[model samples]
Target: MYAMPNNDLEEATPWLDSGEQQVWRRWLVATAQLYRYLDEGLRPHGIDLAEYDVLVHLSEAEDHRLRMGELAGQVHLSRSRLTHTVSRMESQGVVLRRTASHDRRGVVAVLTDEGMALIESVAAHHVRAVRRAFIDAIGRKDLMVIDRSMAAVIAATDPASGPPDH
Candidate 1:
């Protein structure tokens, strides 16, 4: 193997200040832990957070259906990944896909009665998990702070979206 090259460019890095670094590391670990904690609660439901999110969007959609492309964007998943996830859910009889009525070229994912009932059943559990893992942990007084901070981050990161509609 060739020896690694040392360069001044590599040493000229700009790093976070100590306070920011502490918060950044904590935020990283906390997010991972929170996600895993919530996902564990959904384990018996046979779906992870991503699948649950899909179920929720489909359930809230008009006539319980949304075009695949829209679903992918809403869920922050790439089209191919959403297709794969929906395929699996289809096999599990939770969702079904059909060509869009208004747009023949587009496909729509529809939530079945089983899916509706499943989400309704799990919603309470998910809410409890959210409360325990996030809201309660952060406390009510700081909740707005967290929300505002996230909104600012979103505004900065996703200028197209602006403030959250929801």
Candidate 2:
């Protein structure tokens, strides 16, 4: 149970009703289960979801590289966490870190040959997992609804309604 500190709530506060609470709970459960399935699927490749995400983002970038700050934004990771992840990948020769040419103090992450190979090996399985767990389980109409719903939620929550970090 999440413990809320005992504080007098004299002012009005938004709260979910029972139905809304149930929906939130179910969403949480489903998301957790899906994450676990995907994480397990990638474990044999010696990378977790976060690391794989970093790899994918880097691989898809122009010249297969991106600045650390840009990568953090694309992966939804804090700068510090991205630094640590990149450091580990660098040590494994899966990624190369270079000082930015324009800003010597800044760093860029480039996918090495090994990193590309690793992603190539894992991509097929990852796609299958995604398809089996999500797309295959939903009807075409429901999938459309899910996509639209997610887009709407993101538009509502994101500070910039523009394109997401890609």
Candidate 3:
């Protein structure tokens, strides 16, 4: 239980009410737990959640390639972080970076055959993990509600509908 702050209009800005606080707290906890659970499930395959996300995005790209900047946005990673992650993946023969054909100044990350193979190998297990941890836990009805709710949040936050961070 929380004591409501005295509404001294001149003294403080608006703050979350008890109901809003409860929702926010639960959102944070659920996200953290979901990521941890997925990461752990991928550990046996030698990839963390973020890395898996990178591969998944690359796999869906045209010719399995995307500009460095584009890939960063797709994976919700900072430019420098994507560079470092791609560098490591390059050394592992999973991906390679090259100058973009359309823009010499732009770098493009291309998924290698090895990377494709790796993703294929882990796809089934990953799907199962996702189902076990999230989909199955939330039945279809609830999942649909969550989907629409999340879309609303995104639209409200991003009125322009510009490129997303993820």
Candidate 4:
């Protein structure tokens, strides 16, 4: 059997050079700032980005409901994390968790009427914020490139091709 070398860790280093590092650092900063801006925009609606994502996903789901496991996977949250979040939202009348009729072992999370109303009321503001921070800032030509690049990133990070969730 071959033995591992002392320099094994060095082989794991990113391939980025100095210029790539500069570009990557800028991208990281921009990503954080953008998230902060969006979170700030959601403050008035009493929702943060993660909760908003849950709301949006549920709202778009069939009958505004999904299995807890499905919801967690769709929202990219851990099962325990989704349970905690759903519990809080349930207390706020934003959503409800119920036992599945067909499967005793399954739990379903459904957006409540009040939750639907809240999201509907706040959606316009969220859309406007997105437009202001992103769409409005980028030129149409650049936006196309950005869109394509984002799609490529998503494709690359998809479960089948990429490493497990980071």
Candidate 5:
């Protein structure tokens, strides 16, 4: 259990009650375990969660392509990291990098036919994993609660939402 700070200077700041602390700890562990579970499900395809994320974004983009910076942000990878991952995927014939037509200096990531086929084959497995780890565990009645809670979190903290980070 987390103890509330006793310092007079810090006392004004509210600390989590025991119930809140328990919930907070469980949320952290649950998210971590869920991430591991999903990644494990993707292991057979030789791609981790990050690579799978890139493929999913590219698959949904117009013409199966996105500017490198845009894709990096979407996949929550640093530009250099995304570049490295894309390099590995390129070697596997799963993706290709090209100069953006609209901007000579901008790089674009495109999904290859092989990448499409892979996602098509692996998507059902991913969906089932998601259901088993999250949706079914939460059940239909609580889905909206989670949706609203996460939306509030995003609105408060997401840079794209224009909210100042605490």
Candidate 6:
């Protein structure tokens, strides 16, 4: 594996240089702003970005359903967190949870017709918000670079890959 060079002030400790620090800070700010923008855009539809993400995943799954654990991973939520969110969505008539038919011990999250309708209603607006806040703002070439960069980050941090040797 290729390793990044240690460019710390001292040989024993690694630290980000000024340029790297600026990049890190900007990434943090941009991520926060983009999420807020998207969430706010969905507010009028009575769903936040997280809920919208869940609904999208469920809607695209077979029979509009997924095992709870699988859904949690897809939506980047913890099992406990997904449980709470699913409960709330259930109460709102957007989702339903039932024991998995094949595995009695497993739970599944299913999108209701209401959930599908809700996502269909907001998808266009959400796309516009995404374009306005991120895609258009970054331009096509930069967006491509960002996509590749994010994929690299995800690969490097994948749990199955274990820790880096360094």
Best by lDDT: 5
Clashes by residue pair, model 4: none
Cα RMSD of all models vs. native, in order, equals 5.6, 4.7, 3.8, 4.9, 1.9, 4.5
Question: Where does candidate 5 stray beyond 4 Å?
Answer: 2-8, 160-166
Candidate 1 residue runs with Cα over 4 Å from true position: 1-14, 159-166
Encode model 5's per-residue lDDT on 1-166: one tens digit a residue. 4465688856776678889989899999999999999999999998889899999999999999999999999999999999999999999899999999999999999999999998999999999999988999999989999999999987778777785633
Instruction: Please report, in order, the local distance difference test score of every candidate based on alpha carbons.
Output: 0.90, 0.89, 0.89, 0.88, 0.92, 0.91
lDDT of 1 by residue, 44-160 (tens): 999989899999999999999999999999999999999999998999899999999888999999999999999999999999999988999899889999999998887777957
Query: How would the candidate models be sorted by TM-score, starting from the highest?
Result: 5, 6, 1, 3, 2, 4
Q: Using alpha carbons, what is the TM-score of model 4? A: 0.85
Poorest stretch of ten by lDDT in candidate 1: 1-10
Better of 2 and 4 by lDDT: 2
Choose the strongest candidate by TM-score. Answer: 5
Q: Candidate 4 or 5, higher lDDT?
A: 5
TM-score of each: 0.87, 0.86, 0.87, 0.85, 0.91, 0.91
lDDT of model 1, residue 163: 63
Q: How far out, in Å, is residue 158 in model 1?
A: 1.0
The digit string of per-residue lDDT tens for model 6 on 1-166 reads 2246566634554557778888989999999988998998898999999999999999889899999999999999999998999999999999999999999999999999999999999999999988888889999999999999999999999999998756
Compared with the true structure, what per-residue lDDT tens digits does model 4 show for residues 62-138? 99999999999999999999999898889889999999989999999999999999899989999998888888888
Clashing pairs in 1: none
lDDT per residue for candidate 3 within 1-166, as digits (tens), equals 5565665762375567789889999999999999999999888987788888889999999999999998998898999998889998888898999999988999999999999999999999999989988999999999999999998997877838776543
In Å, residue 34's CA in model 1 sits off its true spot by 0.9
Please identify model 3 stretches exceeding 4 Å from their true place. 1-14, 159-166
Clashing pairs in 3: none
Clashes of each: 0, 0, 0, 0, 0, 0
